[model samples]
Structure formats: structure tokens, C-alpha cells
Target: MLSNPRTVEKTALDEFISQYKAYIPKPALVKSEPVGGTLSEQIKRSVTVLDFVGQFVELSPAGRGLCPFHDDHRQSFSVNAEKNYWHCFAGCGGGSIIDFWMKWQDVDFGQAVKELARTLLKDRR
Candidate 1:
């Protein structure tokens, strides 16, 4: 038996992109759905920012708190219930619920969808 374990090197961006593209279904093979309307409408209809955030971290009533995306001393994030949005005032920036998951988990777009889908499904019941 070999004493050392073999490890594969990281793929280059071009190679990675090519591999990702290969897995994407052709336009004819994919079904499309409309994501209609404003971001506010989408959030309001689907889920609240507080509820979404609670899936990843504990939050307070004012909607301001330490962001899960980065290390910080105080809570600087705020969520607008009526607007269905959030912003990190401590220089961390902010965006929609999907953006929060992407930043907090350091994941790519596809992973973010999967994570949110799973979370939302569980919440529904």
C-alpha cells in the first residue's frame, strides 16, 4: 500500500467553468418559469427576512445584529419588513434573502438555491 495519499490539484477557472457548462441542460431540455415582479413583492409573498435569517442565526426584534457573513463586535444589520430587504450598516453590505445565504455560507449561486429550497420546504410544514 502507498504510504502517502494522492491528491488532485484544483481545476483552473476556465476548466471549472467548462465542467459546469457541460452539466447545464440545453435550452430546449430546460423548463423555464417566470420570477415576476419587484424584489419586495417576491420577499413579502415568499418569506420574511427575520424568518429566513433565523434559519442560519439568532436575531433580535429591531432587526439589527452581528452579521453571520463576517466577524464583528456588534449587530449592524437591519431588515425592512415593509420593503422586504436587509442592509448591514457595519460595512458588510446587504441584499435579499438569497444574498444573505450566499454571503453567510460563502457558497455559489446554485448552492444557495438548494439551501434555500430545503430551508423553505422544512418551514412550510
Candidate 2:
């Protein structure tokens, strides 16, 4: 039942940019635009899985916590610090920091990357 994500995602991304374009620093926006491999890698390297996802979910020791993507009664979400990725053994997919953000935020790939870039850019200054 996965709908065509491109259209919805594009609209969402466009809305986000239009709403926050004035607020985003020019330099940060440049890095995330087009959402390609180079920029994606840069953003991924700049962020830690625990640190980025921690803002949204409360993680316990060893990065074990309940899955935020599902109503789980057990600890199924695991964040691998060494690999900088996360997985929900309960069946939810896993990926880099941007992937986690995209699923949780229900936004497109570019939108997720852009938000991460924005945060990283703010920290640089």
C-alpha cells in the first residue's frame, strides 16, 4: 500500500523550503540541495545516530529502546553507534541518520537531509 512517495514528498519539501527559506543559512541550504550522494555522505558523517535520533526518542543504555515506528511493548529499536545506523527488529526498516529522520518525520529523502544539514550548519557556527 505504499503510495507514490515522490509527489507527496516533493510537495512537503517544497512547503518546507518555502516556509523556512528565509531562516536557513545560505551555506547550509547549499549543501543539502539536490540530495545527492556527496551531500548525503557529508551529512551522515557529520551526525551521530544516537545524538540525532535521541532528540526524538528516549534511548536507554546500549542504545536499546522501544521502537518509535511502531507500538511496541518491547525494546526492538537498536542504534548502532559504531555503524552510525539504526534498526527496528520488529520489522521497521533501518538506515543512516537521514533515513531514520525521514521515516519518523514522514518526509522525503531530500527534506530529511536538508533538516539534518540545517542542524549541522547551525552547530558549525
Candidate 3:
């Protein structure tokens, strides 16, 4: 009596993103240190690649690992804890955790934001 995973709900996505944006405290316009940074950096600082991946797949620890995006047993997906980044040695491509979620889930940018917001909030409380 089980069902397939449901598609991303648009209404839910909109509501969640709206709520999340509302909840976040706005940063002041005053310039201090570095004014701009890479979008990837923002995402990496916000969430770890491992935790982000876990939200999609159940990964087991292996010495090295295979690229989940391709068919290979060799462990090539290297996650740098210090850099908070992941790269597929198999040439599968790489980006921030948010990019991974978007690609893996096949969702739009807004939907991804909503999904991330929900996940972060759930983890916090």
C-alpha cells in the first residue's frame, strides 16, 4: 500500500520559500569586509555536502567512491571538508550543495530554495 514519491508541489514550494525569506533577518546595507562572494561559497557555508547529499541518497562510507551521477564503482566523488565542495574525478561535474540538489531532484531554482529552507528549518528545530 505504498506509493511512489510525489513530485515537487509548486504551491508548497512557493509557500515555503515565502516563509523562509520572511524568517531570515535582513542584512544591513552597510559595507564592511568583502562585499561579495561566490554563490557556491554562500551555499557551502550554509550546509555541508555530506548532509546535503544524505537528503537525497543513502551513501555508505568506502575508501574512495564511485560517481553517483555515472555508472562506475571507483570512488571519485571527493568532498573537501575544508573547502565545503565536491568534485567528481570521473568528470561528472561539480558545484555547491544547492546545485547538487537541483540536479538530483530535477527541480527549479525556487523549488530548490523552498526545499532547502524546509530542510534547514527542520534540522534546527
Candidate 4:
């Protein structure tokens, strides 16, 4: 009854695939907000860069200090208490407290935020 066995098999397989393809379900969409927006702000306002960074590295009266991220003889790190920010003139880039924590702890952004949140929210209760 079949002239070409290969063509008949191919046609049957195509029909079978078409019949089952529509039964497959598509993945669901998920919407989520990024971590550490308001909490980071709260910590930035409440904690100064000098006070926070001072715990790790000793700072001069002018807020200039050694950068732990790099090896150097001179202290090229500067912390601006008013702006609650820091920067390393030698090379190491600086930012908010979260940024410092991420580099120091060698963790990702989410882990850093969670770690910071634990300390920041400790006294809330």
C-alpha cells in the first residue's frame, strides 16, 4: 500500500508532532523588585562613612585613611561624612556602605544587602 516507506514514515511523524505540540505549556512570568533601596538609604543616613569604615581601618582627623583593598605605603582613601560616601584615589573605587561591604566580604549584591540589613535592622525591634 505504501510506495515509499521513508516518505510515509516522515509524514506520520510530522502529523504526530503537530498533534502534541499544542499541549506543551509556556512558562509563567514573574515580577519582582530589586533588593536594598529604602533600607540602604536608611543605613546611609543613620551611619556615617567615617564611623562605619573607621571600625575596620583607622582614619585621620581629616577622614583620609589607608585603603585595605590595595597594597600601598600612603593612605589614599577618603571618606566624606557629609555625603556618606568614600573613594580610593590610588585605584580602588568606592561608593555607599553597601558597596564597601560587598567588596570587603567578597559577596554578591543580594548577599551584601542581606548581611547589611541584619545589622541595620537589629536595633529596630
Q: Would you list the rank order by lDDT, best first?
A: 2, 4, 1, 3
Please rank every candidate by TM-score, starting with the best: 4, 2, 1, 3
Instruction: Give the lDDT of residue 14 in candidate 4.
Output: 79
Of the two candidates 2 and 3, the one with more favorable TM-score, higher being better, is: 2
Which candidate ranks first by TM-score, i.e. highest?
Answer: 4
Residues forming the 10-long window of minimal summed lDDT in candidate 1: 1-10
- Per-model TM-score on C-alpha atoms: 0.55, 0.65, 0.53, 0.67
TM-score of 2: 0.65
Question: Candidate 3 at 75: error in angstroms?
Answer: 1.2
Write model 2 residue lDDT over 1-125, tens digit each, in one string: 11665557766877877998898776645444444456678788786988888888789979988899999889899999888899999999998888998999899999987887887756653
Report the lDDT tens digits of candidate 1 across residue range 1-125.
12332443345545766878978878777555446543333433578877777666666776766776678568777777677678888777677788887888888867876776665645642
Per-residue CA lDDT of model 4 for 10-78, tens digit only, reads 778778779989998878887554465466676666577788898988889999988999995799998
Off by over 4 Å in 3: 1-44, 54-63, 122-125
lDDT of 3 by residue, 2-88 (tens): 143266576876776898897898987975543334433344566787766655544555323566788877667766656666677
Q: Worst lDDT window (10 residues) for model 3? A: 33-42
Worst 10 residues of 2 by lDDT: 28-37
Instruction: Report clash pairs, candidate 4.
Output: none
In TM-score terms, candidate 3 sits at 0.53
